[model samples]
Target: MHSKIELIDMSKKNPGEPGIEIIESPEALAGQINKAEVFFLKNRKVVLGIGGAILVAIVGFAGYRFYIDGQEGTAQNALASVVYDFEADSLQKALNGAGGNEGLLSIADNYKGTDASNLASFYAGVALLKQGKYDDAISRLQSFSSSDLLIHARAQSLIGDAYLEKNQPAEAISYYQKAADYEKNEYFTPVYLMKLALAQEKANQPADAVASYKRVVDEFPLSSEVVNAKKYMGLLEGQVGK
Candidate 1:
């Protein structure tokens, strides 16, 4: 059984032919307009909320950038005397302080996230190493960061030297390898390779030591380390032959 459908005759006679009006009444049109207005008002609130969040993020980033710039300036000024002390071979004064000025330790602590602070970490680590504070040196050196490849490489090598002084040949070899591979250059590569070879030898890895030395001799022929690398490689190979 199907349901019946009804059709209403809305046509009215105005002349010979009838006409039909399908337009909404004024009251019905006003209702639709009101509904549209209400929808846009709700959406406007949501748009405003997202805009406010973006504004807050922008303001927060601006404040942080300002703070970092200020810290950079302050740290650079504070490190001046510390660098002088370090160059002058006053390792204690470089690490701590001399006279009324602050040293690398204080500067690094005060401006913890600045480039100058990272340099302070490096200076303080080297000062500690010179003072025979191997663990402290390692800690300070590891805290330092730099965008400059040469500086980063040197710092890694310095850490290896600290480990060597502590008689930890395995750790020394690890850092030496890191330094060698950190920034491959004619100057630093041969230097770190020599140190890596020496560390391998100290660790009783004669074969590995020989390989590292040969790399320096073959790849960095013009380097000062080449002479020493050739000498050590020959000595180790002879021992291996026996």
Candidate 2:
């Protein structure tokens, strides 16, 4: 039997009233369910996006660690081999290497992205310089760069020496200035300062030459370059007044 329904008086209601109604239609109910499912799907997408980002981060970190560890290992081994040849003064063997062994050139070529390769480039430049291949030395040294202050400064000094050997006094002076400014250490600083002063003298800039020599003598009196600096300073001083 149908349940009994009760109705309150509605005579006080305004005209054209649509009356109170309850939503029980099947299609309307289906639409509500569809909306709830859509909301859940949207939330699922957000969760998936966050999970994907975290997964990418984890994978990237692992890959970077592996790459760094591999590079470090390779660098240690490569440096050891090169150091042996360097100590023995085996320039040709060091650069070319024996069969089944890699040389500095191989390291520089095969491991270009690694720090060891960068160091190999430096050694190659030094080797070329020792062989009196000034142009090749300059090219190799100029192409190598590093963030390590000492290494970077030494490279610039080596490049300056290459230019000096090539009889390019102006270029040598420029590179010497760069080396001196790169590292504020007692060891290389005075040496580069002396070179700069000498180069300035060669370039006919006696005033600049005197200033550079004075800097070496005043700032690094105990350095080996200081003695030479003092003599140059005296000569430049005498010339300045004339």
Q: Model 2 over residues 40-102: C-alpha lDDT tens digits?
A: 787988878899999999999999878867876786597777768866889877787775678
Which lDDT tens digits does candidate 1 get at residues 163-189? 999999999999999999986999889
lDDT, candidate 2, at 1: 47
Instruction: Give candidate 1 regions above 4 Å deviation.
Output: 1-54
* lDDT against the true structure, each candidate: 0.86, 0.82
**Model 2 lDDT on a 0 to 1 scale:** 0.82
Report how far residue 131 has shifted in candidate 2, in Å. 0.5
Superposed model 2: Cα runs more than 4 Å off: 1-72
Top lDDT hit: 1
Which pairs of residues collide in model 1? none
